[model samples]
Target: MDTGKKVGDLFGRLGKVPGRGVGIGLQLLVGAGGLAYGVSQSMYTVEGGHRAIIFSRLGGVQNEVYAEGLHFRIPWFHYPIIYDIRSRPRSISSPTGSKDLQMVNISLRVLARPDAVALPRIYRQLGTDYDERVLPSICNEVLKSVVAKFNASQLITQRSQVSLLVRKELTERARDFNIILDDVAITELSFGKEYTAAVESKQVAQQEAQRAQFLVEKAKQERQQKIVQAEGEAQAALLLGDAVTKNPGYLKLRKIRAAQSIARTIAQSNNRAYLDANTLMLNLTDLGYDQGATRAGTSKK
Candidate 1:
């Protein structure tokens, strides 16, 4: 019984010591946690649409790029730089001058991606924020240079060509920085107020000029119509004069026909009408062709 109590006391005293089994256990726990942390750091995952590049403390950036999947690296000697290799959208805007010295505001939309194969070079030179570093600079450069080659009117008229030129130049330029442009476009464009007003005024003036030309043509056509009418009236008068001179009885015949038409009109009227020698229409009856006797009134026998 004394031996058992003494052994129990000894164990209790050892447990109360400043550092022994407890210190060793704490040290072992710390070592295990550090080892677990290092292993976790050594293994990384590259998700879909992402790429990775390695930087070695001793050897510098590796020339090879890592693709999506599980990848391994030396925990302390190497660091991984991950990049989004997917096409992403970015825009740039600038106020620039045209070839005609007109102020123009333009915006460009770029669909860009880091060249998958050039990821190593990109990390070596440009680092992770490659798009931020290169896109705006190249967009502005291309926009300004392309805009300067066109007049304000041409810029509006040849907008498609301008966009094409910008895309070509910007693509070539961004390529140098290990950036690939999936697509490029000039999304917005506007001219200065003064230039816009001038364009509108010029269009209005052209319309007015066209209207004036139309009016002049209309007047010419009307004048031609009047000249043709006058010629026809003169020719008809000449024909009548020659007929009267050639046959003296023609005037008498014409007069007789006019009297007949007037008499018929009066006869057909609904109102009662009376006639005397002066008031009655002359030569209305079908009188014979002897002038003296016809002038003498003849009733139908």
Candidate 2:
């Protein structure tokens, strides 16, 4: 009976301990909260236009890369480093020497992005600031190399070609560092003030030469037209003289026609002559009437 009473007393004490089951539940709840916090920490969401590279504490960088979305990893051991895969623009001003040893200032724009397939390699080699580390230097080197192959005037005239060559060289070089070169443009090209002045002077001189040539051609054309007119007039006078030599009666016929034309003009005038019709007929001999009469008389005989 005494041992039973002592056991009942121990049970009563254990029951009397306030909220013992609640204490055990609270401990379990704290443990679950910690586990949930750790799981939350292990999950990450990569946003649009971004990719994540996982780094393992024990194994180093993982081959697998995470695309834009939710991803899971081991808590505290694996972390995601996000990189922007969007195309970015960079402008660089490079001063270089031309083939003619002229100082050329070139402003260029480069559109570039990291190779998505080689992002891991790029991160390993160049990190997040890959553009800053690799592109500017490569662009400068390639631009200078291309510029050295062309003269200052060529840079102005063959700007597109120069840009193409630079793009090609830059693309090849950038590929070595796992970068994609989308496009390259030469925005501006300038030379020294003296060179510009010389070019302007040359253009002005060429224009003046063209104007002078045009004036000379115009003078030649006018001289040719005058010479042709004089030749035509001389040929016409010579034809007339030959016609007169071939037929002596042609002059007498012309004189008669002129006299008849004068008679018609005098008849049409407003002023009346006081001469009689007989006087007019007598005056007709002055034209070739007498010659015609002699020819007729000889023919009849």
lDDT (0 to 1) per candidate: 0.86, 0.85
* Tens digits of per-residue lDDT for model 2, 1-301: 9999999999999987878878988999999999999989989999999999999999988888789999999988999989888999999998989999998989889999998878888888889999999988998899899999999888888888888898889999999998898888899889988888998999999999999999999999999999999999999888866655565555557666776776787899999766553444434445456566556545544
For model 2 the local lDDT of residue 274 reads: 64
Error of 2 at 224 (Å): 2.0
Tell me the lDDT of model 1 at 282: 66
C-alpha TM-scores of all predictions: 0.70, 0.70
Pairs that collide in candidate 2 are: none
Please give the lDDT score at residue 163 for candidate 2. Answer: 84
Deviation from native of the Cα of residue 80 in model 1, angstroms: 2.0
The residue-level lDDT of candidate 1 at 178 comes to 78
Clash totals in order: 0, 0
lDDT of model 2, residue 60: 88
lDDT of 1: 0.86
Across residues 1-301, which tens digit of lDDT does each residue of candidate 1 receive? 9999999999999878867778999999999999999999999999999988888999998888888899989998998888999999998999999998999999999999999998888887888888888888878888999999999889988999999999999999988997888999888999889988998999999999999999999999999999999999999999977766565466668767777786798899998777763354364343454453334323211
